[model samples]
Target: MHRSDSRGVFDALVVGRGAIGATAALGLSRCGLRVAVVAPAQPAPSPLDGPGTWDSRVFAMSPASRALLERLRVWDALDAARVAPVYDMRVYPSGREGAPELHFGAYEACVEALAWIVEGSNLSAALGRALSFAGVEDIDARVEAVDCTAPDHAALTLAGGHVLRSRLVVGADGARSPLRTMLGIAATERDYPQQAVVANFETGLPHRDCAWQWFGEHGILALLPLPGERASMVWSAPQELAGELLGHTPEALAERVAQASWHVLGGLRVLTAAQSFPLRLIRVDRTIATRAVLVGDAAHVVHPLSGQGMNLGFGDVAALLDVVARREPFRDLGDALLLRRYERARREAVAAMRLTTDGLQRLFGDHTGLPLPGLLQPLVGARELGWRFVAGSSWLKRRLMAHAVS
Candidate 1:
């Protein structure tokens, strides 16, 4: 029987049915919590996989993320052929020729691969199906308001006039999380002065299952491997450079990209419509507020150049699940103390990621200057040094990978 507390209408009600929210609902349900998910509508039918159906939205899922998905049983559900293993990664220094590159390989990390490049569509389809199997109730409506102070203190009022109650509310919403706002949670944000232009391309040269990144003069370009000589591109460029990129026609874009990449992949041919989004670092001082907690982009977002955004969200889910799993039977899920455990657990990891990504973005960014005080090095000098240190230190990389590979 459900507890008689107002939040006991259900153990948790997750607002925002994006990938993060859906994943949260699935994980909590699997943990034996009475879970309900609120979404704008039932998920649209997943498209049938076909030739020339490559999705532009791709993620380089870290090994840790893979474990979470595997544990959730969503990893194997995705069509295996659609995924590409990132056996190697090469990162070049910005605007430098002959600089030693920082490289990561499966062998170095003692893992099968550094990460897996997965299509957003493929993962979504799998997670959607998994949510149902996990027995999470689906509420098909938009969340217009969330009340954390009422008889059902954590009640969510839907746009359609339906009210759903829960002992705890989780905001898996994106960067602009309405649920976060409803709980009066504040966050620190900094624009990277960059925008990401993403798309799919058929490369003249095979990627060899390698993910490559070039820190060029005006932007950071990453070509993540896809099957059969295809790769996905994420160019995090300055505002004007991003505008220039978006203005180019497909053929022009390919030509420009190939030139920018120094013909690393021989040549490039656009295979899909391009997409762009501004980049920013969002950090919440506290992820928990009253009876509600935030996860995924709702809690924090870092620069995508590191390709750790999705992985970080998965980390958030994993951490939250761990806290929930170890809670005392007598402790209510929404207990302030129970919620603080979740906050403390995540604070350090989240802070390190923010500092790393934000620091790197600023370093390689068009901005001039060293982030350190009284450092008399030119921008070029610092960038080279950073790359060299990463390239030189196996122990450092392995330690980093331990946290990264999950």
Candidate 2:
């Protein structure tokens, strides 16, 4: 990597080209500013070979995320046939046979839909086209160094010795962000004892555009609807259970999942390979520093059980864009005062999501053995009572139904 400064200064330089980073670049370009995306060279996308070949990675995008994508002109660009809308959600207490269920329906809440389940590939394709059409500069190179000491601009040294500078550097990179470390930002992380096993399955019964989740003793299980008679599964299982499941053949895994889901959608057939990833909660102390700011997983991470991790990241993108768009004419993009506005707007919401997911994990933690502990009984009873209260109240249901969708 030679150290020659080839690229000129830009209004903003975004690091990482994942969904959040791509969206950030697109959103900033709309401000009529020149933005450059610094990331590894992207391989050409291969054409789909057959019908219904879906990516294992999927996200249940909240309403807030959808609106932000729409603002960036990406929503309408996505393949509508492949997207699935969730009109209702059913959540059941774990480890209980006849526990009361908590339900949230968009119709009852007077909303169009609760959330949309989107395939990762569809999002990548949609965002990819938008980025090209938006005319954001793409510098395909590995980052050699990050220099933020400059008074006016933050600079990045590429492997080829090319230098890229910008008034503001946005880190929309995922967790383990090299940009976050390059900026000397530190994050606090806690490894959840659970690992998420995710896959797609073709269901015997139609999902009816509803999402189902069960809090079981082994872990939290969710079945998110997909287009047609298909559903995606996110089984946040204990480490031991995850290991066992990963060892099963596709047919065996299908049977296990069917039994666990109580055959609600009848027998299931695997549509994608089973994949597992460890769960964790991560929080960075500062989202913004001198001439630099962090967004998405680069800033915060939460347990996948709640399915709000990505939504929280999208919220960061929206907040930061709002701050930049509304900045006073005299203030630069990296103005400390302006970045603080974005950070402040995101703090409360991020903290709430972290606390909720962590609390739920602890509340339903494993207590199984030869004989159940006496204290565990009351805990279960209390959980049941709480469920009854929440399920019986229209206000609480509405309140929960609005979670992270704002």
lDDT of 1 by residue, 1-406 (tens): 2223243489898887877888889999988889988877765744746777788889999988999989988899998999999999888875688888778788978898999999988888888899888878887877787777864358778776667788899988789888787778888887777799998899999899998888757778998999889989999988888999899999999998888777889889998768898888787767998789999999998889878888888888898899899999888889888889988888888877776666666666546553532221233456667667667878756755665576
**Candidate 1 local accuracy as lDDT?**
0.82
Worst 10 residues of 2 by lDDT: 367-376
Q: Can you write out model 2's per-residue Cα lDDT over 1-406, one digit (the tens) per residue?
A: 5454656789999998989999999999998989988899778655543566877788989988999999888999998988999998898876577777888788876767888999888898999899999999887987767898888888888877888889999997789888888888889987877889999999999999999988867788899999899999999998999999899999999999999888989999999889999888798989998888999899998888768988988999899889998899999888889988998999999887776676656555433422223322444546666556656868756655667456
Whole-model Cα lDDT per candidate? 0.82, 0.84
Backbone clash pairs for candidate 2 read 1-159, 2-160, 2-161, 3-161, 4-161, 94-215
Candidate 1 local Cα displacement, residue 119, angstroms: 0.9
Once fitted onto the true fold, the runs of candidate 1 whose alpha carbons sit more than 4 angstroms away are 1-8, 42-48, 150-153, 368-381, 394-396
TM-score to native of every candidate shown: 0.92, 0.93
